[model samples]
Target chain A: MARLEETTADGRTLMRQTPASAEAQTANATLARKMRRRGEESRFWWLVPTIYIIFLMLPIYWLVNMSFKTNQEILGAFSLWPRNPTIANYMVIFTDPSWYKGYINSIIYVVMNTVISVTVALPAAYAFSRYRFLGDKHLFFWLLTNRMAPPAVFALPFFQLYSAFGLIDTHIAVALAHCLFNVPLAVWILEGFMSGVPKEIDETAYIDGYSFPRFFLRIFMPLIASGIGVACFFCFMFSWVELLIARTLTTTAAKPIAAIMTRTVSASGLDWGVLAAAGVLTILPGALVIWFVRNYIAKGFALGRV
Target chain B: MERTWNNKAWFMVLPVLLLVAFSAIIPLMTVVNYSVQDTFGNNDFFWAGSEWFDEILHSDRFWEAMGRNLVFSAIILIIEIPLGIFIALNMPKKGWGVPVCLVLMALPLLIPWNVVGTIWQVFGRVDIGLLGYSLRALGFNYNYVNDPFDAWITVIVMDVWHWTSLVVLLCYAGLVSIPDAYYQAAKIDGASRWAIFRYIQLPKMNRVLLIAVLLRFMDSFMIYTEPFVVTGGGPGNTTTFLSIDLVKLAIGEFNLGEAAAMSIVYFLIIMLLSWVFYTVMTAYDAEQ
Candidate 1:
C-alpha cells in the first residue's frame, strides 16, 4: 500500500483508489493521516519563507541603513539602525544635477526601449501567433537565441556601431541596442498571450469590417491588454537593470544611473551614503513595476508561454 | 491550433526583422570582421585567417576562464535548483503569505544587477557592513578583498539571494497547476511521502524545472555584472569568469582580434550547450 498524503501541494487530505491498489483506504487511517498533516502544516512550515524572506531583506536593509546615515557614521561606527539618520544622502542625489540626472537618463532610455520593443514586437508576435509564414518556426527560434547572447559579447561592437551612426551618448542608442534582447522577449511573451486568445475573435473582428491595424489596436489589443502590460513590464525591467551594454553605449550625455554610480566609485572618493541612496532609489522603479504586475509575475517569469 | 499560410504574413514580421538586423546582425558582423583581420593603426587591416582563433584555443587564460565559468555554473545549479524547490514547496497556497512571499522574493530579481553586486560589496565590508563586522567580531579572518575563498562565497551567496526567487516562482507556478484529485488518489493508494513526491509533484514540476535549470545555467554562465561589481575579478584571478576576461581583453587591453575570436567561441559554446540541454530535457519530458 502507498500513502499519497504528500501529493497535493498544500497538504490537503482526500482519498481515492488507484488501479493497482487492492483495497480502499480505511476511514480511521485517513482521519489519523489528516491529523498528522494538520500537525505538520502547523509545525512551522511558514518559517521557511519567513526565514528566506528575512535573508533576502537583510542586505536591502543594510543598504537602506547605510543610506540614511552620514558617511561619517557609516565609517565611524556600526549600529543596527542609524545612530543619527539623516536625509542628507537623499538630498545629495536630488541636489546634484549630475546625480539626479542619472535617474532621469536611466528613465528616459528605459521608457524608450520599452515603447520601441513593445511597439515592434506587437505585430511580430501577432504574426507568430496567427500565421504560418516562411521560416516562421526557425525565425522564432533565431529571435530567442538573441536573448541568450551575452551583453558583454555585444558591448564593443555596439559602441562602434552607435559611434558610426553619430548616435553615441544618445538615449536612443541605448534604447535601440537594448532592443537586441528586449524585442525578442517582448515578442515571445506577447506571442504566448496572443495564442491563448481564440482565433475566432480575430475572424469575427475582421468580418465586422475591422481592418487589420484597427482590429489589432482597437479590438484585439484591448483583449490582450494584460499581455501588453506584462510585456512592457518585462521590457522595462530588463532595460532598467542591465548595465553593461547601456554603460558601453553611452559616455556622458546619455549616461545611465548605473554608469554614474560606477564613475562615482572610481572618479571621486567613495561617497558611501550617496551611493547607497542611489542604489535604494534604483530599486523603486522595479518595485513599483512588480507591484502592479504581481499577479502576472509568475506567468511573466515563465515568459507567459507556459 | 492551425495557422493560416498567408504569404503576406511576412509583412507583419518585417518590423522585428529590420530592428533585430539593425541591432544584432550589424554589430555581430563587425565582430566577425574584426576577428578575421589584424589592425596595427588607423585604416590598416590584413587577413589574419584564424590566427587569433588558434591563439585563443591554445591560451591557458581562455581555457581557465571557461573552466571557472563551467564550475561556477555547476555549483550554483546544484545549490539553487533544490533549494528553490524546497522553498516553493513550503510556500503558502493561499492568503496574504501568497502576495508577501511573491513580492518580497521577486524584489532582488528586480534590483539592478550592478546594485545587487554593490549591495553585497558593502554588506560584506568589514568596517561598516553588518555581514563583515559580524564575522570579524566573531573572530573569523573573513575578508573578501584579500581572500579568494571568501570572494567566491560572497559571490555565490549574492547570486542565491538575487536569483533563487526565479526558481521558486517557476516551481510554484508548476506546483499550483496540479489538481487535487491526484493527491486524493495517491492518498487512497497508501503511497509513501517520498513516493508521492517522486511520482507526482516532481513529475508535475518537470517542465518548469527544466526551464529553471536551462535558464539558471545560461544566466549563471554569462554572469558578469554582479560578480564584476563585487570582486572586480580580483584576488589573483580567482573570480574572473569568461565575460570579465573577455572584456578585459577587448576593452582594457585593446586586444580586439583575440577578444573577437573569444567572443565567437563563447557564443558558440553557449549555443551548443543550450541546444544539448534542450534536446535532453525535451526527450526526458516526452518519455514521461
Candidate 2:
C-alpha cells in the first residue's frame, strides 16, 4: 500500500521530463501561479489547529488553575486564573505517604510493564516480519483481539486468577495484567516497523556469521531504533493511562494513582484543589515522556505503524 | 517481503503466547466455566447449560446497554475521524510548529483515563466549572447531573476533546509520508484541492486511518472510566454502556453467572465488529 504513492510519483517524474508541446510550458507557469495563490489563501488553515489546541488546553488549564487554589478560592468564585494561589493542595499529595505511594506504584508498574512488553515483543515481532510460521496470521490476529478486549470481562476473572496465585496487591500483578493489552500493541507496532526494514540486512548479517541474538541487538535493533522508541512510548502510554485492570488487580499496596484518586474522592468530601493538583501531577510523567519522544512519535508513526 | 517457512519461529512467539494464555485464556476459561453453570453465595455449583446466556439475551437491560454502546461509538467516530483529519491537514508541515502542535495535542492521550473524566466532571459543574458557568451566564440551563440529554452531550464533548488528537496524530503521520511529488503532479494536472486530497492524501492515509478507526471503535465501545466518572451512567441508567453495566453486574451485584454471560456477549460483539472492520479495510487496501 505504501508503495503506491512512490510508484505513481516516479511515473509522474518520468512524464515531466518528456514535455508534450510548446503550450505545455505556458500551462506549467500558470499552474505554478495558481499553486502559489492557493498556498497564500490556505494560510487561514493554521487557525484550525490553533483553535483546536486551545480547546484541548482549556479543561487542562482549568485543572491546573484549580490545583493552585485552596478550597476557599475554588468555592468563592469562578475565576479563569486563581486569585489567591497556594501550594497547600499539592502539599497534601506530596507529604502524605498514602497519596504519594500511588504515584510510586503507578510508575513502578508502568515501567515494569513497558520493559516486559517490549522485551518479549521484540523477538516475536522479528519472527513475524522475517519468517512465515505456521498459523502466524491467526496468531497475530488472536494477539490483537487481546488488545481489543474490554477490561471489564477480564477484571473479575483477573482478580480471581491473580488471587489464586497470591499475586494480588503486588506491582507485578498489575504489570503483567497490563501486558494482556500492551504486549499485543507492542507486537503490532514493532512488526510494522520491522517489516519496513529491508530483508537483505538480515541475510547479510547471517552471512557475516552474526548469531541471531547478536544480529538482533547489534544490527537489526539499531536499524529500527526509532521503531523501538515508538513501541515503548505506546506501551507506557497504555499501561499508564489504563485503570480498570490495574484497579481490579490491586486493592491498596499496588493501587494505581487513578484508583487512589477515586478512593479519595469517595472516602472524603470533594477537595477539588487537591484532586486537581493530583491530576496535574499525574499528567507530568506522561507529558515528560511525550516530550522526550515527541519527534520519534511524529516521524516513526509516519511509517503507518499506528 | 518474502519469508521462508520456519516452524521454529514459534519459539520466538512462545513467550507472548504463554503470557497471553496465562493472562487471557485462563481468565476466559474461568468466565466460560461461570457462564455454563450456577453458583450460590459459597462456591456451590449446579449444572446449567447456557442458562445465563439465555437470560442475558432476553433482558431489555442488556440490549439497552448494548444499544447505548453502539450509539456512543458511532457518535465519537463520526466526529473524531473527520475533525482529526481536518486538524492534521492544517498542522504545519515543518519547523517549530510541528513539535509544538504535536506535544500539545498528545497531552490528553497520556493522562490517566479517569482523570480525563474528572477534568470534564469538574469542568462542567454548574457551580464552579468554566464551561458550565459560562453557559449559565448566557441563560442556558446546563446541568449534566440532572438532565440526561445534558449528560450525554457532556460525555460526547469530553470524549471528542480527549480523543480527537489521536486521530489528528495518526492522520498527520500518513499525510507526512506523502511525497511532495504527488502534490506537484496534481498541480501540473490542474487538479482541484479536493481532488488532490481524494486521490493522493486519502489513499496514503488508508492504513493509519484503519488503525485509528479500529482503536477508537474498540475503546469507545468498551468505554467505562470516563463516562462512569462523569455521569456515573446516570441521572438514571440513561448513559450506561455495556462496560459500565457489566462492571455493575459483575462487581457491584456480584451476580457472577449472569455477568459472566453478559461479558461473553459483550466481548463477542466487539470481536465480531472488529473482525468486520479489519476485513473490510484490508480488502479495500488490497484493491488500492
Candidate 3:
C-alpha cells in the first residue's frame, strides 16, 4: 500500500512540472525579444542628436565663412566656401588701434565686474543659504527686480547719473554699472548651490574650533568653487556683450567692442569685412572663458552636492 | 550649534548694495528728475509737472510702440521656449558627442548680440547672404531691407537663432539632472513614450521652463541692439519696439521729458511682470 502511494505522488509532480517549465521558457524568450527591440530603438536615437548638432552648427559655420571672405566676395552671390579666402580682414582688425583698444577696455571692465560681483555675491549667497534674516525672501526678490529692469529704461538715467558724478568714460563706471544685473544673478546662482551643502559640514568645522570666516573661506569656498567659477563666467560674458549701458556710459575711453562695431556703419556704407572680423574677435574672449568653465557649468547647476 | 544672528553679515552685503545704489538708485533719481522736468538744451531745465507723463500716456505713438513690444515679446516667448525644450531634449547626453554638441550649441550664445545681428544682416542680404540668395534662387521674393514684412521676419528669426540657445542650455541642464531610475520605473510599468515625456520630462522641466520664459520675455522686450543694428528700426518704424522708440524720443528727437516718462512706465511694466513671474514660480516651487 505504501509503494502504491509513492508512485501516484511522483506521477502528479511530473504532470505539474511539464507545463510550468514550458511557461518559464516562453517568458524568457519574450523578455529577450523585447530587449532586442529596445536596443534597436536606441540605435535610432542617434538621429535626434545628429540633427540637433547640425542645426546648431550651421549658423556658426556661416559666420566663420563670412569672417574669412572679403567685402566684395561677401556682397557677391552665395558661395559654399570663400572663393578667395584671405586673412586680410583679420589683419585689419589686429592692426587697428581702435579695434584692439576695444578689446583691452572690454577685458579690463569685464574682469573688474566679475571680481566685484563674485566677491560681493559670495557672502550674500552664503547668508541667504545658511541663515534666515528679516525680510530675507523679500530682499532676494528685490535684488532680482534689478535684473528685470530694462536696460533701455536705464540708458538715459545711467548716462545722466554717471555724467553728474563724473564717473562717465571710466572703466570703473561700466564695471560698477554692470553690477546692477550681475551681482543679483551671481548671488542667486551661488545661493542655490550653497543651500545644497549639508549643514553638518558647517557644524563639523565649528567643532574643530574654526572661526566662521576662516571656515567659510577655507572650507566652504572650496566646496562651492564650481559655483563661483560659473557665476564669474556669466558676469564676464554679460559685461562683455552688454552695449547699451557701455555705449551710453563711455564715449571714448571705455568704449566696448560692440560700441566700436557700430561705428563701422558710416556714410561710406558698412565695412563688412572689418565688421565681420571684429565680430569674430569679439567672440574669442567669451569662447575662451566659457571653454575654461565648461566643466564647472554642469557641476555648478548641480547645486554643489554632486 | 550656536545660531547667533550676526548683524555683521550685513557688512558682507554692503559692497553690493553700495554698487547697486551707485548705479541703479542714482540713475533712477535722475530719471525721476528728468520725468518731472523739461530740458531744452545746455542742461537747463523747467518743472514740467505731469505734462510729459500725460503726453506720453496719451500719445498714440507710445501706445503703439508698447503694443509692438508686447506682441514681439509674446511671439519670442512662444517660439523660443518650446523650440528650445525640443532641441534640449534631443541633445546628446553622453560620450564624445557631448562636448561637440555643447560647443556647437554654445557658439551662437558666445557671439555678441550686435555681431549676431551683423551675421544675420549679411546672411539675409539678397545678393551675398546665403539665406536670401538661396530663397531668391528658389524663386521667392525675399528682401528684408525694403519690405517691412520681410524685415520683421528677419529680425524675429535672428532673435530666435541668437537666443534660443540660451533656453536650450537651461532646459538641457534641467533635463539631464533627472535621475535614470525614474525612466527605468516608467519602462517597467509599460508606460508609452508620450506618457514618459508628459508625466516625467515635462514636470521635471517646469522650473527651468519658468526661468526660460521669464528671461526670454524680459530680454526680448528690452531687445534693442540687434534690431537697431539689423534694420535701424526699419523701413519706417515697423520693427521699432518700445526701447527703439524710447531711444528715438530721447536721443533722436531730443524729447527728454517724454522719454523719461515713457521709460518710467516701461520700467514699471517690466518690474511688475517680472515680480509676478517670480512670485508665481516661487509659489509653484514651494508647493512642489
Query: Which candidate number has the best lDDT?
Result: 1
Among all windows of ten consecutive residues in candidate 2 chain B, which has the lowest summed lDDT? B175-184
Report every candidate's CA lDDT: 0.87, 0.86, 0.77
Off by over 4 Å in 3: A1-44, A76-78, A295-306, B1-7, B40-42
Sort the predicted structures by TM-score, highest score first.
2, 1, 3
> Which regions of candidate 1 fall more than 4 Å away from where they truly are?
A1-42, B277-288
- Candidate 1 Cα deviation (angstroms), residue B29: 0.7
Instruction: Compose the digit string of candidate 1's lDDT tens values, residues B189-284.
Output: 877777767998898998888888888999999999999998999888999999999999989998999999999999888778757665665478
Model 2 chain A worst lDDT window (10 residues) = A1-10
Candidate 1 whole-model C-alpha lDDT, 0 to 1: 0.87
Residue B244's lDDT in candidate 3 = 89
Docking class of 1: medium
The candidate that wins on DockQ is 2
Clashes of 3: 0
Q: B1-288, model 2: which lDDT tens digit per residue?
A: 788899999999999999888899999999999999996767889978989999999999999998998999999999999999988878886668888999999899888999999999999998889999999999999999999999999999999998899889888877777754566688878788788789988988888888788878888999999999999999899999999999999999999999999989888987897678667765875676
List chain A TM-scores, every candidate, in order. 0.87, 0.87, 0.82
